[model samples]
Target: MIDTAIPHKPNPTFEGLKRNKVWLASITILILLAILSPAQARFSLAFTLDALLHTAPFLILSIAIAAWAGATGADSLIARVFTGSPLLMIGLAALAGGLSPFCSCGVIPLIAALLSMGVPLSAVMAFWLASPIMDPSMFVLTTGVLGTEFAIAKTLAAIGLGVMGGLVIYLLARGGALADPLRAGIGNGGCGASNLRTPQPVVWKFWTAPERRAKFGREAVKTTLFLAKWLVLAFLLESLMLTFVPAEVIANTLGGTGIGPIALATVVGVPAYLNGYAALPLIGGMLEQGMAPGAGLAFLVAGGVTSLPAAIAVWALVRPKVFTLYIALSLSGAFLCGLLFQTWMGS
Candidate 1:
C-alpha cells in the first residue's frame, strides 16, 4: 500500500508555522537565489510577475469552477453521466478537459473523487490528458505569443491527444490489463482531499459558509505556492536559455523538418517545458530564432502534457501502467502533431 500521508511537523527553520508557511519560506528562497545569479534576477522577476498577472484570471476561474463543482456534488454526477457511451464520453471529456481552466493540481482532487465514484477509465483518461494543456486563458495567451494559427492547432491537438489516450485506456480496461484504476490511497483521500465522498447538499449559499471559506483559503494558498515556485524556476531557466542560447544555433540545430527534429523536440520538451504560461515566451523566442513551426508545435504539445508537475500529479493518483500510458500518449501525440504540421505547413 502506498502511504500517501502529507507530512506536517514543526522545525527550527519554521519555528511554529504550518506547511503553508514553509511553502512561503521556500518561495522566498527562490527569490533570493534569483538575485545572486547571472540570470539577471530583476528581469526574471519582472518577467515572471508579468506572466503571473496574465495567468491570475485563469487560475482564479479554474479554482472557482472546481470549488463550485465540489460544493454542489456535481463532479461525481458528471462522472456517472459518462458511463453509458464510452466513445462519446471520451470525446466530450476531452473537449471539456481542454476547455476547463484547472491546472493539474487544481484537478487532482476531482480526479480522486471521480475514481472513488467509479467513473469509467476512458473518460477519466481523456480528462487527465487534456486538463493541463490548454484552457480559454491559455488559448488567448498562446495566440498572443505564437500566433492565431499556432493557438488553434494547439487546441485541436490537445483534444486529439485526449481522445487518443481515452481510446487506449478503454482498450486496456477491456483487456483486463489493470487490476485497479485508482491507486491504494487515492479513493481514501490520499490525493490530499478529505471530502471526496458525497457530502451534505450545498446550495447557492455554499460560499457563505465559514467552514467552506476556510477550506477554499487553504486550497488557494496551496495552489498559489505550487504555481509560484515552478514558474519562478521556469522563468529563471528561460532567461538563462535566452541569454546563452543564440538564434543561429537554435535555427541550425532544430530547424530541420524531419523525424530527428521531431523526436528531439518531444524528448527535450518532456523536461524543458515547465509551465504552459512560461513556455509561451520561451517558445516565441524560439520561433523568432527561425525554429521550425512543426517543431514548435511538437515542443508545446509534448511539454504541456508531460510536464513534471502534471506527471507527478498523475503518478500519485494512478498505478504504474496507467502512468506509462499517459506519457506514451503524450509523446506519440506530439510526434504526430509535428509530422502533420511539417507536411502541410512546410515548416
Candidate 2:
C-alpha cells in the first residue's frame, strides 16, 4: 500500500525539484540539445509547443472529465459493479475498468480494497486488466494524437483483454488453482481502501458546494501538471526521434504486417514504455515513420498493463502465481488483439 502522506523536510523547493524528475529530465535534454546543436534545440522546442497546442482542447476536456469524476466521487461507484454474479461481475468490471478515470498506478489501491473486501479475484482481475489500458483521459489523448479509430480500437482491446483475463482467472479459481491470490500481508489496507469499502454518494453538481469546487480545482491542476510534464517530454523525444531515427529502420523493425513484428513490439513494450500519455506522441511518430498499426496497438496494450511501476505494484500486492498469470494474460491478449486488428486493417 502506498502512503499518501508527505513528510515534511527542509528545503521544500529542492525536494519538489527532486521529485519532478520528468521535468528535470526534459530540461536536461533541452540543455544538451542547445549546447550540441542549437538549431536542433529550436526545432524541438517548436515541435513540442506545436504538439501541445494542437492537443490543448483534448487535454482540457480530459482534465475536466477526470476532475469532475474525482470531485463528484463517481470513481467510488466502480466498486458497485463487482457485486453481481461472476459472469455479470466480470463483464461489468471490464466495462467499468475501461471507462473509469483511474490510471494504472491509481487503480492499485482500489484493487487492493476490492480484494480485501472479498470481491472475487476474477472480477478484480477483469478491472485490473482493463484499467491500465484505457481511461477517459487516455482515450481522449489517444484520439487527439492517434485518431478516433485508433482510440476506439484500443478501448475495445482493453475491454476484450479484461474479459479474457477474467474468464481465465474464473476458470482457474474453479479448479482451486488460485486459492489465495494476494501476498501475505497485502490487501489488508491501502491508501484508498476506505473510499471503496464505504463509498460516498456522488454529487453530480460538484460546483454547488465550496469543498467540491475546491476539490475539482485541485484535481484539475494536479492532473494538468501530471499530464503536461509527460507530454512535453514525449513531444521532445518524438521530435528527436523523428530527426535522428531513420524511417527505414523503424519500418524494418516494427512496420511489417506480421506476427513477428507485433510479437516483438509486445515484448519491447514491457520494458520500453515510458508513460501511457508520454507514449502517444512517440507512437504517433512511429506510425508516421511506417510502423504497423497492429504493432502499435500491441505495444500500447502490453506496456500500459505491464509498465515497470504497474508491474511492480502488482508483484508486490499479489502472490507469484497470480503475478505470473497477469503477465501471461497481458502478453497473450496483446498479441491476439494485435493479430485481429491487423486482419481487420488488411480486410
Per-residue accuracy of model 2 over 314-345 as CA lDDT, tens digit each: 99999999999999999999999988898899
Which sections of candidate 1 miss by over 4 Å?
1-83, 189-236
TM-score of each: 0.71, 0.95
Name the top lDDT candidate. 2
Q: Which candidate wins on TM-score?
A: 2
Question: Residue 226 CA error for candidate 1 (Å)?
Answer: 6.9
Candidate 1, which ten residues in sequence have the lowest lDDT sum? 72-81
lDDT of 1 by residue, 10-84 (tens): 585565334455346435645675667625666666666776686566556654554555454443333333556
Clashing pairs in 1: none
Please state the error at residue 94 of candidate 2 in Å. Answer: 0.6
Each candidate's clash count = 0, 0
Which segments of candidate 2 are over 4 A away from where they belong? 1-15
